[model samples]
Target: MRKFLLPLLFILLFIAESLFVQFLPGDFFGGNRILAPRFLFSALLLLTIFVGRKKGIIYAAIFGLIFDIVYIEIIGIYLFLFPFVAYVISKIMHVLQANIIVAYFVSILGIALLEIGVYEMDYLIHVTNLDFLDFLNLRLYPTLILNAAFLLIFIYPLKRYFEKYAEALRDE
Candidate 1:
């Protein structure tokens, strides 16, 4: 029963993120810029930090595919990107000390990488008219700041929960 908690929490966070997006004021950006929260990614980052990269990659693949199926017209974009990002983060973890500040930056880096990958893919496919500068100013910076704040606010509790969660799994 305890094992189910984290996965259930992830699902709830996913739903909350979707709902939260709907509640955001439409003009919050006040222009063409968009400020969206990637709470799911933040959750995944916590999972990666406290659980392990292997579990993180598994969760990423499952959630990424779900994200693609529900939100995207294309099938494989997020499906491929999420796990790939998780894997990269897992690799990067070996070199960096495992600490709150490091984990926060790693989460931000993961979000940035995902965003850039999507932007580049869209640009290559001619799906977006926005150039690199516009993307940086309008999308990436705002997203990074918002997500960094999310990480700041939630990291400690999440880390404690996941650490305890992992310890329980090991004891069993």
Candidate 2:
């Protein structure tokens, strides 16, 4: 049960993200389009920061696979990118202090990386018609606002939980 608790939490975040996007009113963006929070992405980054890079990458890959399967038609985009983002952030965190502020920047960077990955994939397949500026103004900014708000609200508690879990694992 202990081994699976972290991943289970990730799955719940994924479900919450999906539900929030679906059920919440789109007026937050003042239009029909909604900026959904990236709950799993933020959770994975926290997992990496508190737990360890190796376990973080593993969980990222697992959740990324589920994300790709459930959310998008493209299979490899998130499956590959999510773990990649975890690996990059893990390296960056080694050089910088791991704290709430740093986590916010890293989460934003992760969100940017994810967006770029999706954009590149879509471009290759010619699925997206929006220009770069439009994509930035319309989608990226709103998404950053939404996900960053979530990170602000949840980061401390989630970090505490993962830190305690990591300490327990070390003692065992």
Candidate 3:
């Protein structure tokens, strides 16, 4: 029940973030860009790592699948990429201490880089012959900053809630 609840709650939050991103006006914050859904994904990925690798992978895959379905992108890209990110993060979890804030920051930064790289590579290989700098300045930077800021603000409480929830699960 505990295992199920954590993931379920995470999924609910993910869906909420996705809907918000989809419906909200991008110009709400003085025209600065934001990838609201990606921030949730980063937080979810980091939390999953702290919980355990297998559990984290499961959460990432689920979130990625939902993200893929909703967003106007290649269908399987996020589903494939996000779980792989979680898996890599999980492998290195032992080397890092159990500091939630640090993990959130690191994860957000990594995700930002990953998102940019993936976008560039996809464009280069399949989408267009566009200038790389244009993409970076126009799209990637804004999304990265927004996602990272969201992670910084939300990581602590979400981590604490998940920790307590996991502990309760264990006690059962």
Candidate 4:
């Protein structure tokens, strides 16, 4: 139960966030120049780190798959990329523990770059026609910034929650 609960909770959070993106008022507040979905990806990356590499990879893939399904994008792009990013972050988790703020910022930045790279690759290969720079400026950057800001507010709580849960599992 302990092993499953956290990932389940993360999934719920992902669903809620997706709903907010789809139906919330002011989702793209002040036009599309202000926020993007990059934060969601970043948050997932952070959560995965706390959860451990294998679990993190699983969650990232699940999140990406769900995101891809809901957003009408290519089926496996996020599924492939998100987990890959999580795996990369997991490898660096040790280094990141020195300073979480720096870790989070760097993780988010990496996620942003990964996102852009995937999109660019698709576009270049004619799988997509998205205007790379416009998409980054108008959507990706804003979303990433919002997500990073959210991390600033919630990282400690999330870390504590995971630690307590992991401790409980150990006691079991």
| Residue 138's lDDT in candidate 3 | 59
What is the per-residue lDDT of model 1 for residues 1-172, given as tens digits with 9 covering 90 to 100?
Answer: 8878888998988898899789987777666668767899788867887789889989998999998898888888888888899889888888998788898899899999999998898898888989999999999999999889888999998888888988987998
Ranked by TM-score, the better of candidates 1 and 4 is: 1
Clashes of 2: 0
TM-score of 2: 0.94
CA lDDT of each prediction against the hidden true structure: 0.87, 0.86, 0.70, 0.70
Best-performing candidate as measured by TM-score: 1
> Which residue pairs in candidate 2 collide?
none
Query: What lDDT tens digits, residue by residue, belong to model 4 across residues 1-172?
Result: 6678776767767776767666755734665474544545665666666656776687688877987897745788777888888877777776767246766766776667676767676877798666867877876777677777777887777767766775775698
Q: What is the lDDT of residue 162 in candidate 2?
A: 92
TM-score of each: 0.95, 0.94, 0.80, 0.78
Q: What residue runs in model 3 are displaced by over 4 Å at the alpha carbon?
A: 1-4, 29-36, 128-130
The model with the greater TM-score, 2 or 3, is 2
Tally clashing residue pairs in candidate 3. Answer: 0
Question: Candidate 1 local accuracy as lDDT?
Answer: 0.87
Native-referenced Cα lDDT, model 4? 0.70
Q: What RMSD, rounded to one decimal, does every model reach?
A: 1.1, 1.3, 2.7, 2.9
Better of 2 and 4 by lDDT: 2
Our model 2 lands, by Cα RMSD against the true structure, at 1.3
Q: Where does candidate 2 stray beyond 4 Å?
A: 32-34
